[model samples]
Target chain A: MKSLDIWNRTYSRAFLDDLPHRWQRRAFLRATVKTATVIALAPLVSSLPGCSDQRSTSPPLSQAPWPTLAAVQEILLPHDAFGPGAADIRATPYLHALLQTSDFDPEERQFILDGAHRLDDICQEQHQRAFLMLDPALRDPLLRDLAESRVGDRWLGALLTYILEAMLGDPVYGGNPNGIGWRWLEHTPGFPRPSKGLFHA
Target chain B: MTDHYDVCIIGSGAGGGPVALTLAQAGYRVLVLEKGPWLKTSDYFKDEIACCRRSTYTPNLRDERHVIEEREGKNWKAQSTYDSGWDFWNGNVVGGSTNFMSGFFFRLKPQDFQLRSEFGPIKNANVADWPISYSQLEPYYTQVETEVGISGRVVAHPFAEPRSTAEFPYPPTAEHLLSRVFDHACEQLKLHAIPTPRAVLSRPVDERRACEYAGYCGSYGCATGAKGSARVALLDRAIKTGQCEIRPHAQVQRLISDDSGRVTAAEYVDTVNNIQRVRAKIFVVACQAVETARLLLLSTGPKHPQGLGNRYQQVGKNLIFSAGGSGRGEFEYADFSTDQAQALKQIGPFVNRSLQEWYFINEKQLGGKRKGGTIDFLLRHPNPISRAVGLRRDDNDELIWGQALKQRLKNEFTRAQYLDYEVFCDWLPTDDCFVSLDSAVKDKWGKPVAKIRLNSHPQDVIIGTYLSNQAKTVLTAMGAKNISGSASTSPPQNLMAGGCRFGTDPKSSVLDSDCRMHNATNLFVTDGSFMPTGGSVPFTWTIYANAFRVAEIIKHQL
Candidate 1:
């Protein structure tokens, strides 16, 4: 239960500086995969460490570590004023687990994992560090290139698009942690709570 | 008497929630009795195993499943009755079914209100004209939409009933992952893929806000209160006013009768701790269709030995279950991707109704394997569960199954959208497909459970087949591959109708046009049980409308 603001300050661009372009993309994909995997495996790995009610557990990051993967997720769905980022809500591991389970099909698993591999290869050939380690300048360009590519295989752009969507999507699927998504949308989290003026204590 | 009120309403779901609020607002002392507990949105979770398998959010049905037997073939057939499909099917909470509904709202067509005259009398069907016309109920329908804060567009359809200009209180919710595909496919097919009208608020209305893109809106309860359940809309206001008193855990067993054959009060064993009686000058039975009919039958006295409203034996007669069907398709296009499609704002509602083309589909034949029926309303944006189970691919190249299936399903698992169009033909009431009391068995409270002996006639089968084929054709036009359809073996008794049907003829029907029970001078029935003929649309909106209408009638009387 780290303060969300503390987590945010820890994730500034300075932490991502000096890493090469290709490596940064690879790292991002890795984090996305890890997140899905953790979500899928949350039920089985309940006793890993932190268990805040079965349904409310953020993904287990320690026992099942996806270093490159976790960092990349931070970059994409960062915990900011925008909403709950995947990693901020600690959803990366849950997502990683989700990928392996029946929740997702084999093609989706392959797309996520294979797409990460392809991204990493490109980053390695160009810049030096994995995607998350790269400077924001280098990392941003790589993401743009992937998104704009219509070449031998359009894996980078497509995977980035999918991951970003999931990150910004619903809290019902491990994203938008807490009422964070609602706050970002300028709406209240739904249910049982009374309106701002009516019936609120 | 433990407590007394000017008007006492039973069951706090669709009918009771609205009526209680309206009457209380109008300054009448109203008391509402609810059998289920009141739950908030936070109580719900997003686990299919718990919600679907464990039956976490539905009525406990262990006894009824064993006791109620249909005379199947020669021997009595016992259907394994469980909760329909989590909270989405049947919720036993204080908000009633609204707590777990997709919120589709369609008005009963003009013809639906007068089926006996328009369609002529079909053999064996208890077809009759409604005491009131659709035009008479239009104002109340408008009031319901406004109060519930519906988000819809009044699309133009030739056969659609006319009404004053109205716009949905909020905009339609954004299509879900699967809905995007269905939208694109519908655009390609040139057929109307209307936004299913939902009771949910699209923008903040009153105290609630728009949808949060939570994929669990359909079956599982919405903790956000964005969906227009009674807890969110009516019950809260009614309770806050303090003019209405809600007595939870009061499961009414029988309607007490005076010496004059009028319902004097209701008897019940207090589900909480104490068994007590509460008398009211007026009584409204807002219990759902099955329970309403069963209560009427259980309270048999000398004046009405058959039941409360069974002078003509029509109390539990003409049971109409929703005639339901669906179609699924797989498409190849990146544009249909969930990410890109969210930008294309505005999904249309099945708001426009055409009697010529979009009329209820019927399967004329019965007693065997036949295609299902159709009502209008294409439901897009189904969450994961519906896509996994209901929208599976078939054995065709375009359909795409097996190993490639694994890849495609995986890729689109979160992105692929399943477009669904459900047709609900208002089942014409038949004397045979009705609810009765199981004399041999009882429930947890030792009251007779609702014994449903239902078998749809050949006409119902005709309606089913017609609707199912029409659904297939609509999907075919949309390039839907691996199209399939099947009718349920059980009769349309599932949709529910008539324990207290409304008509002018006291000898034939139970209640009057205002929903007042014929025999009981002060007792009124306001649920789906009072429906003369089931409308060819989802019944919730109409049910709310009728409740409002009756509330107005009660208001005038008060």
Candidate 2:
């Protein structure tokens, strides 16, 4: 039941106020049972911090030629059966913004952008198709070749790892919106307070 | 723009706040200048984005973002060291690091002071004997303990220093579900699992309230004033005394010294819109490690061109950082999140009597053999996003498709345990990993920014490796699988110690055993920078103890 429905049923402040002095004891017992039940489900409810504030969808990804980057993201983390596609989910846009920001290392940013371009070139040469346009079988092999097979670019592997991590980071960073990846794996996104460090094991 | 005072204390956190309070209480005209703005407790939030991601604690990003660089002659040094760890979450506001600290407080063991006398000096380490012993500082520790209202159980560990104390103000933090498992595991291995000493009040004591166990103790300021921070505990007392004045956002640029080399006044730029000058009879640099070193290095005069206390080229040497690692366990009957309230449990600076050989001492070798750094195991509080990101197990684990894979993970998570380790050891004092001015790098105030040059010793690496391996052994015995993590040996040194290290000799050390700088007869440093050797115990308690001791010294000497 929704919280409002449950609250309306057993926790009407009016009902308690109207109870006779003798019956007040029984009413308190009834309230205790209801409060305990509400508390037992509190973890699922209270773990969410600022989750209600993240109600809006991401901004549109309509500028520039990000097709190759979008294709790679989809191939690595395909639109799941339950969630939005990789490009449509704002992973690339978020990655673009983080890389462009002053917070990230300049070298790290250049490596990521350059690696994506290099990866798309290899895909086009091998299969005459953009990386996203290729079948999973062909795209997977091509990505592996670029990521590991002594591709002249030493930072290729690192770039791939960075992209993957960015895609998987907390949605508050603009990736993994609405816990799409979490929902796909049946995980509940618990709002953790950082100052508190990690919660108890 | 500002008036003068008898004593001027730079930095308003742990070291600065107390001295300000004590001196003001004793009727000294004092001025406490904090570089950062004052943040109200309510303004502090639990958002990782605004705080952790943006580096809000030490923000002014143009100067704080550090990158690892390989200098041609020196190996990789912290290219911009002042703010490398600032990203992890430290308070830059009036409270200093204490605003974001977990409030874990522990006294140094008696052996920690006489490392040279207890443990033989290892090659490539500058482990020196502390001027004062635990006994001398014991009374002051209790005074701080009462003032701070620490909650802990004082169980005598064989490797611990003997204490002439009673029990803590409150019992240990209740063993949440996680600590019970950790305690059970350690009991089987005979490793003593002592109560973790915390500055968070377990029961309401003094004006401070009891901890709500809200699980927001590390990075954010406690809203309820439960955590014993300088802002909540003592800063108010200092201001109320009317003898002390705290000028927030007053960034001290340089110590204005006369031709005689005595610091007569300090020139500062008030963040609020004015140039300021404050003269004082004495100055105390309690602004924490990096900034404290930076301030001293920036203060140059005709008599001391190399900076006020850099005559020996030892101003910013001996930097140490408390090191950390993590381990995980998988149990058949564990539901990691079942008991939600117990998620804040922590293990302790337990004893390791046989590990004395792993340490280093600068003076005579220690004859009585026993040493151990603090080991902490905080339960891995994986929110759903963090869980999905790192939730993995290796067993040639059959790839169960879609829904089944989800179910498998949920099941495994319900039955898993994790342990994180914290090791505080002495880092060798190196002249190279010191601070100097980077003329090119300027802060918001146009003052020359500090270039932090820091690197770890090979012995620290060895100790880190040893601790990592030992953590796995304890976890393996508890039937946990896939335990891995290293104490990082990269750009950021996690355990930074020894800049302006304390010693008996004035020529070699910045401060006397009493934390008073020798050449500058009226200055003293009581923060982590004065530590001769980093003990396994956390630095806050020691810093507090020394601050009290130094305050007494100043009271009597003056």
Cα-based TM-score, every candidate: 0.67, 0.74
Model 1, span B1-558: residue lDDT tens? 867788988888888988899999988889888776666665554433234433333444443332345676787764334322111125566787788777767777777777777767777777788989888888888888778767766655445567776666666765543444454655565544555567877777666766665555566676667778877788888887879888766778887887788777777767554677788888999878888888888888767788887888778777677754544544333545455444322232222221224463233444343222234434344333323322223442122222333334345443333445555664556766677777666776777777776666665546656666766665565555556664443543324556577889988888888899887778888888788777666688888889989988988876
Recovery fraction of native interface contacts for candidate 1: 0.01
Specify the poorest-scoring 10-residue window by lDDT in model 1 chain B: B345-354
Q: Give the C-alpha miss distance for residue B320 in model 1, angstroms.
A: 0.8
User: Global lDDT of each model?
Assistant: 0.58, 0.59
lDDT of 2 at B169: 66
For lDDT, the strongest prediction is 2
Residue range A1-201, candidate 2, lDDT tens digits: 132233234324432222211110111000011223234323322433554322222222332235556566565455555444455345575565555443444534554565555555656677776656778677655654553323212333333333333444455445555656544444333233222111111
Q: Is the docking of candidate 1 incorrect, acceptable, medium or high quality?
A: incorrect
Q: Which 10 consecutive positions of candidate 2 chain B have the poorest summed lDDT?
A: B347-356
Most DockQ-accurate candidate: 2
After superposition, candidate 1 runs with Cα above 4 Å error: A1-201, B45-47, B63-68, B74-76, B79-89, B175-195, B332-356, B360-415, B487-494
Write the residue-wise lDDT of candidate 2 on B1-558 in tens digits.
Answer: 357688898888888877888899999998888877676555454543344333455643444433323345645534443323233225567777787776767777788888878876756667788888889989888888777768787775556556667787667665555455556777787777666778877777655667665544565567667678888777866778889888877778888677777778888877555878888888888877767778888888776688877788777777666643434544433433444423422222221112222333222233343344555555454333334323322254211222333444455444444444454544555444665566676776676766666556665555555666666676676556667666645423323456888887866788888787767777788777888777865688888878988988877766
Model 2 lDDT, residue B57, Cα: 54
How far in Å is the alpha carbon of B452 misplaced in model 2?
4.9
